[model samples]
Target: MTDKTTSPPPSEEPAGELLLTSPPTFLGSVEGATVEAIAALAREGSVPTILQVPTKGLGPDLPDNVPILWDRHAQKPISLLEEVRAAKPPLERVGTAVVTTLASFIELTNRHKDDGSAIFAKTAWPEPKLTAVIDYHMPGETKTARRGKHRIAYPFPLTDEFKVWVAGHGKTFKQADFAEFMEEHAAELAAPDQYEINTFEPMFKERFGTPAEILDLSRHLEVNVGAKMKSAVRNASGERQMVFETEHTGANGQPIDIPGIFIVSVAPFLAGDAEPEVVRIPARLRYRAAGGEVVWFYQLYRWEFFLRERVQDDLARAAKETSLPAFEGAPEMAA
Candidate 1:
């Protein structure tokens, strides 16, 4: 005869070992039937573990020792019971706060105001300044308080916008990548000419930043100039502009105006003066014929001078934009 014994159901068994401590801990669920070794790790008192949930189910049995933080969208519809906490009590706090988003920050500000006042009140707080980590690191309240009553400081992480732009000052890009670099800093190319920057360049696939007819004509000339380019730009439509003909018309009873070899405009990624003071750069277009192919390239006259002028103009503009005191020297890390 076999020994008759009753055992509990599988569901009734504890999912895992739960440590009832200051912050209740759950060291992951148990594995399948295998004798495994456990290594020693810091206990609840030394290093308490935090649990994050996507749902707002603070359901039936919650341990008082554990606190769960779930980022609930502040504007989402909530239950009547959720409203109870708003009027519960008047608590005071003077602790430092760093909100994750501007919306959340605004929500918090609105929540703390008097009964019927709007979240975006006229007396609402000003935007807190984003100070560098070094400032927060130094000793004192002036740095902590920052510029306003509400403040948020960030650790100078590499991905921060300011950090990224500052880092770009030291970066180098390949010729192939130069176009992308120009695109990214396109705004820097627009300080002149009110707000519109008109340019005619032959490299791009389509007409841009210039009058329809002008750009179309420029691209037409560019693609038709060489046999290789003609092959590259030709389409199935077989539409070609027969601009040049095999004939002799030195002057058709009138003086022909020859387009200047130089292209006069602001250099890319450079600050240029408002015209008619804009610099005129001569771009000598010369084609290289080798290996039965033609490659086109241009040499800009006075390019170095243009760069030097732009840098000086940029520095001068920087000085004019702000009233802050500045000195000419390399920037140093604030100790």
Candidate 2:
């Protein structure tokens, strides 16, 4: 197979042969083609930069091939169908970051919204400031998701304006408040007396389903409590856990945080004098022996309430900074 970059030497061929030399392709006529290949095709066809996402027939039933669903273009892009770019604003996000730090986010926001002389605007030419639609993940899930890694996207207010709002109305443009905010959150998180898990109550373990979340300890489970390693081990060679279920209480009370970051975005920036996120919630380790396998239990203090209150507080702050009315209710996310 010939690569896109290294094409075969030019050679004259018959008209019939020339037709087969390069098959005509629109934007996405070639599947799994590289961006360079798509760009080459677009240039050859004079495709417009603007594009549109498709919709489905009215109210298609389940299992039906519905175009209205966004997943149809989840992996493949909309413009590849024929154009180099979307004809107008797209409802879809440009991309996602599997791992994003808080600092990287802040830096990107400042560059675009505050100072874009070098990175975003290189030509010294006039152009609308760029805004990216993206989804990003951070360690530790909050109450709503009930899962590790906060998948931030819509309703989380991951916008340039929102970033500025989070930074306290662009006060310093350094996102100076983020570290303080995170530290306070961490302190509160470390001690969540707010959680009310009364296992002693008979109603807890009734005829109903088991309320506790059960997880099997495995290599995939990575635990980080703080700057230093906090671990308790009974037997290294043991199958899963130590001799007793609750013997190894490594870093139970101690709470470590993620790297000190200001914010994260596509553009590179300095770390500045930031500290690791004060992701304060402390964790508890408990285990049970079941069928010769150990089931480990880890819980975050005041998790659900914490996540909700944190977001709400952020909203209130943004409102105060922007001099706008705070949104009273939770924002709905559409599938």
Candidate 3:
């Protein structure tokens, strides 16, 4: 009858197939990991790439096989993006290159006991020398909007002391804000006197103190003039909150029994023979409890340094000599 062999309707392409067309080669297992991976890719070649990573708070660490973590938990993505974007053009212009990895950064930060906080107490360490000045702009929030101010400025001051430490040991300027904050409030932090008793002592006494045993308990606990003090108060609802800080070092040599908080700050400055100024880096390390160990994790933040031409030249020279084969030539080509 009818020679109607109608062709079947054309099938739509599958979404997975469409994605495979590009085939994302440069991928990470976390969100901000893109920055470091992209930077690495740029150093290798100006190849376009895409990265994928686990969403925030999904895990404590980067997923297995992921090349980089980007330390998004320590710093926000927008900020990191801004830094990379701002640094890109200058680095390219000067023929310089850089590669950052989460594993390298973590290793750098973990090299010292107490994360180099001990250096501050050494007194022999030279005072921080001004290098480049880094300017930080706080993110806009509802509270800032209400105040008609959207940003707060931060300054990072770097010193030769820190540079030496970084050169010999791969230390990072994480928690710089805590260090800066503490320096700002140094005058306010004073050790308690012998006559003064901390707020916790009353609780200790009420739970375990007799009038005759009070002095013995205090002595047994090693309470003395230089001891730090702290207090916690319970509201009518029986909820407890810490009121203030004093001074005390935990088993890990962290400021556990201290009364006040320590905050770090950062700024940019010039260093080495490089005439052009660079970003100043500062950091602070504080002790916190984690996994039954008194470990220290830093809340690293940085200030912006407008990437300059000369600085880029210096970086390029350095990159040419380092592991960045793309800057010089591919390994096979060089061979």
Candidate 4:
């Protein structure tokens, strides 16, 4: 009997109205330019949103208004050993040891050049001065113990050869003084094997003032030995559930599934040693269609490193090599 004004039921509300009433809109994008646009919108007091961009080149220019949502991706290519080996230059069947030794020397010298300060900081060793001396003995025999002793007796006088050595170590030493100092040390510097003597020249100059500084420097300038990190991956759990099994189409318009495994191993720095520790670290991977022309949506995956104790066993062998007095100052933890 009441005048019932017919009203629409709550369920009859429009979807857009329901959406608007439910919550303020939050949007997300991964493209850099798109993120810039969303940030502009946010600055105007619009609804807050999130955008995720590839970690590749996102610089400091990111806006303060927008929040970043990082989604981890599982690292692909489960095995890194083959991949790393394949990446290296082909080794000759003969003279493998010599080649490896030279390669190690070159690598060490280049590393010293690039981050000499960092290396010195870690070791508390003085900066090495590169010098070159004429080698009276032939190349192959120069490394032998007897030859090494003989060379030490007539130590090559430091000369322009030192400058050349520094330059060969890295191109960054253009301004470094090579000849002036050699003339100063000409009286005291004794010849050692060309290779070994040259390697230690920089250390000698750094620790000692002149020829008199060699023995003291030799005591402290131990070769810093450590493993190089090859690759790494972390465990997959918790938040990692997000990147689980999103499909990815391949280059030839085919679908390829990628699994997550972050593997990392140390590169051997010393000779006659087994591999160093293989530790897994956290990592993310991205996948996209491989076609040259058409673009596709990229998929992200997250995974964690699965550490194996066996890797440590392999690293133990290298650890043993460093036990001798010769390697006392090598950058390594006590066994």
Candidate 5:
């Protein structure tokens, strides 16, 4: 016969683990006394893990030893809790002493205050969700202590107002088309504007700065005209515009998605019929959010004014079937 041993009910089993959930922003605050309490508990041989929910930017800096995880929206909700519980010894349930700091979540939801006030509870499942607040810190003091605290400024979302402003800036000419335009009108623009820098170019430099770097692709040894670009919008400001989407990966390898629209503006120079019908065509990058639904983030490169000499040289070289000179200074990959 099998041994007749009685098993204790689940509630009377060995102690379970503690799990804390909070917005990443709250984790860094000086007012995170509750988190500090959890950290202390964790240091004292208690197994308390933190689950950080994503926000607009980088999360708070945390200790190296704390076992922290992410609550990715892509994954199943509370899956981390289930995972920890499943990995525990016989009678322990994960999230037995779960605490949540809902302040960040609340602000994100309501778009308001940034106080570190939170909701604390013993969050075991199959039991009443409410429990005693571990930190007896009062709200009024927290509010008073945090008066006029400004949060770190985050990137503004694209709005309809910004889109209207971008639309009013007139047509965007594609880089390739503008290059070809420069090439086609090379003879007309070559001599007069050859060495002359536009007075407004200095202002442009002050505003946008020099190019981050340039990719040198002159070595392949072929002469070609800039291609006609595909248009996203037909005629936003009376001229066909080309919109290009690209991604920027920072030094840390994080990818930033961006959509840049190129607008080419031409101002006539009164060189008269005797001289070349010289015109100053400024090619600019109109950068909006990746999806093209938001406000303009920035005006990136001052393409025409900066690259005028290079463009003219390349066009002249292509016309004569001469190999273009290789770019110097930095390696191509530096860009």
Candidate 6:
């Protein structure tokens, strides 16, 4: 297999046979050096300057000048991927790769009355002024075949307008704000006094199918419940716990034996800057041991049951306000 060069050697096939075949492909590395060489040739008008992404996809840090054809199977907003795949034949005919991030681009290009003033938020990256082109291989396309490498032919013109959008928009690309958000959440988790578990009493009753009680201890880290399941609760390690009784001195000075059956677990929450008020909480129920220690617990599986109602309502509100951009070639995609 030959690596596509500026001047590919003439094949031994007859001229008429060559006409019947597809254009030859250049297959090799799409690293920074390889892309730069292709760009140089494209600028000189020596060869077509279209790039097709491999099955593995390109690295996140490719230069802006290298417009890429993103594979539909790679990452997601499924609807957008469908739209891109549907538009492939037309896009191939025009010789330009469709480049945009997320499903927001679809909404942006095809604006509707339902989409009001919502702004789609994305972590913008700072790179050269070029729209990141992405595409996948269409059936019957030609490419070079090498060990651990394959090529796809893209014979399209990279227009100036597309370049400008990629360069300008890429600057807004920032990293996801999960780190800071998790830090704040962790701080709240470390200090029990920062939040009142009592406030969640009604929530626990609604979620666990019975009222929950707070166990009297030096530190109120756990909630105790009395719901008896057909099966026993087991912890993550699959350990079973024995039910226990502990002596509790009542207000009247009488010794009371408290029965501890099950232990309640705290749920994990995740928040972002955009929806700081919303949290995803999971619920876990566990069994108590003879030593007044929680040994076995059920998994925290249901997300909706533990999530605060107000947070869920707020997220729904934010969904309505989300908006997308009107890409330069979006209209052509529909055509």
Say which candidate scores most in TM-score. 1
Candidate 5 lDDT by residue in tens digits, 1-335: 78898987677545776555974665557666888987887665333335544443445673434344433433333336778788998742112222222222222313321223222122221121221111223346744332221221111122232233234344443433333333343332211132223443454442212221100100110111123222222221333333332433322334432212222222221111223222233333342232332122224234334334433332243223312122212111110
Q: Pick the winner on lDDT between candidates 1 and 2.
A: 1
How well is each residue in 1-335 modelled by candidate 3, as lDDT tens digits?
A: 87888899887875555444574656644556778887787665533233455466666775644333243333422224666687786421111111132222123223311211111011111221111101111234334211111111111224443343234222322222223323343433233232223432342331212222322211222111132322221222332222222344332334423322112221123333334343322222234432322222322222122212323333344333332211211111110
lDDT of 6 at 283: 30
Model 2 per-residue lDDT tens digits across residues 49-120 = 333444445465644342321223233334244453555554543332321433443344333221111111
Q: Give the TM-score of candidate 1.
A: 0.26
**Model number with the top lDDT:** 1
lDDT of 4 by residue, 22-87 (tens): 645458536778889878876654333345435544568755454343222322223346778989
lDDT of 1: 0.32
- Count the clashes in each prediction: 0, 27, 41, 28, 4, 23
lDDT values, one for every candidate: 0.32, 0.30, 0.29, 0.26, 0.30, 0.30
| Model 2 lDDT, residue 321, Cα | 39
TM-score for all models, in order of appearance: 0.26, 0.24, 0.16, 0.16, 0.17, 0.23
- Using lDDT as the measure, name the better of candidate 3 and candidate 6: 6
Please provide the root mean square deviation of candidate 4 (C-alpha atoms, Å). 39.7
On TM-score, the stronger of 1 and 5 is: 1
How much is 168 displaced in model 3, in angstroms? 13
Q: Model 4: residues >4 Å from true position, as ranges?
A: 1-256, 260-270, 273-283, 289-335
- The alpha-carbon deviation from the true structure for residue 251 of candidate 4, after best TM-score superposition, in angstroms, is 9.0
